[model samples]
Target: MAIQTIIVGTGRHIPAVIVPNSAFMHHQFHGPDHQPIDKPNEEILEQFEAITGIHERRYAPDDLLTSDMAFLAAEDALASSGIDRESLDGLIVAHNFGNVRPNAHRSDLVPSLAARVKARLGIRNPGAVAFDLVFGCPGWLQGVIQTDCMIRAGAARRVLVMGADTLSRVSDPHDRDSLIYADGAGAVILEGREGEPGEGILAHAARSDTFEHSTMLLMGPSYRDSAFLEAFFLKMEGRKLYRYALHHVAGAVKDCLDKAGVDLRTVAKVLIHQANLKMDEAILEALCRLAGLEGAPPGLMPMTISWLGNSSVATIPTMLDLILKGDLEGHAIRPGDTVVFASVGAGMNINAVVYRFPRS
Candidate 1:
């Protein structure tokens, strides 16, 4: 039997505060020049919805911090896995921004979010190391990959990995891109299990292209001139980032599938990052083309962006939790199913993983 890192439980915490596109109608939109956009608000939002497929998104209440969301999701995972908190060998948390106060203009990260979550989970094992990962939007999947390596290397038997972010707290109200951000938390427990070949994690791949595209997704002052000039909000070179993802993200997914020696037709699902509907569609088409297919099979990809918006690192894991819990209609992963997870984000980074559900 081969030791494989397998997902034993999953959970997510989606905030109850819903922010719809109409909420932005009264706000003045600005371009990169800090000048007013010429388009009318209705036309702008209509096009935004058509492109991004985000009609609404959730926001954490002002009372909850990023660590709070992570802790909630972690508790859910622990309950689902029925794993003892003290038995966890490692705890990893992923996020781009630290704890950002809903009413303040600053972010905090003095004590790592993982440490805070460890305390909240009541995991008193000093040997159960806690740390954080900051790999952009691919952070959660990257955390999963790292946990796999640790288990495979005999450094850990069970690990808890989580991705949570409150992007709404850091978004610029004046920028159109701000409408694309949301907040949520998702987590999964991975444990080393002895299983036959072709189970659990099979292969993974990652890439970083910072030399030329480092600024594609970054932080800058508010798009509105002279407004909170001292504070920075999440910013992006929209077209550049879109083009970069289209050109590279598909290749990364294809590389992982090839390394796993799995054919595209055998894949049950491709859970790519939910950045934009159109961008993800194009990446799937490109991945199929790389495999000598004309296009992706119908229903091969499941998306939640239309309703959940983009929650950065939390998107994929949250989606996974929903599907596994029968909350996401029309999707299910059965035993022995092959699934591929991929994401692209800040750091100009990209990663893909091939996994097979364990056959009990």
Candidate 2:
């Protein structure tokens, strides 16, 4: 008998502060002269929205930490899951910069964010394993993959997968991209179950494109591209990363569909990372072309960037929780629907998962 993993509970937590694109309009950024530079205008705001499709995002208060946010989301998931905390076999967290404290990256690597979450949850299983995964934006999905494997191997009956980040903490308030980053956390409970065929994560594709060449998409504190101020914040080669996802990632997704033995046209919904609205649209078009569809599937992809923006690793899981909770308009997952999840992020990592949403 083959075992499969099913999502028993899902949760998300967003900071209280809702920041709009207009909020950054009147703000000043670092200039070449080390002077304040404000690129504010009606046209700039309009263009920013047009290019990114991010209208607003949330920012945690100064007091809240990344682990704090993840704890809250995990609490909600455990509460709703009807699964006792003692039964959780492991905790897997996906994060990049760990916790960021205003302008500085504060990582708790010694203890690991997963262990912190495990203690916070008050789980009784001492032998339970917990760890962190740093795979950029695709991290949460990667965590999902790892947990599913553990369950199938009879290593654990249940696992908690979480993604959380406080991008605003390290974001360069003066940088134009500061508007795209925000804070949030998401969590889900995966339990091993004997399920019908075409259920659970049917197939997956994971790959890394960077080896000898530096992608220069995500970087640490350093001198930014010809900027006067130090580039301690995350930077991206937006155009190149976008093209990589569209070309290489789309092909990977096609292979994932082939591996799953499912036709692309039958995917009920595409649950993609809420990175950029425009890039998501382009990815969808590529999927359509790969599937040989005359047109992209209508209402097949739901978006959160317009409102939630990008929260690093939290994007996909948080977006999934939103749809599951019916927080997103015109998006709902009925029982026994097929879903395809894909994400591409730093490390030049790309992954796609074909899942049969549980019948509940």
lDDT agreement with native, every candidate: 0.92, 0.82
Predicted candidate 1 versus true structure: per-residue lDDT over 254-316, tens digit per residue: 989999999999999999889999999999999999999988888899999988889999999
lDDT of 2 at 352: 89
RMSD of each: 0.9, 2.5
For candidate 2, the clash count comes to 0
| Candidate 1 deviant stretches above 4 angstroms | none
Q: What is the lDDT of residue 359 in candidate 1?
A: 74
In model 2, how large is the Cα lDDT of residue 71? 88
Per-residue accuracy of model 2 over 312-359 as CA lDDT, tens digit each:
889888888888888888998888899999998888899989999877
Q: What TM-score, computed on C-alpha atoms, does each candidate reach?
A: 0.98, 0.93
Count of backbone clashes, every candidate in sequence: 0, 0
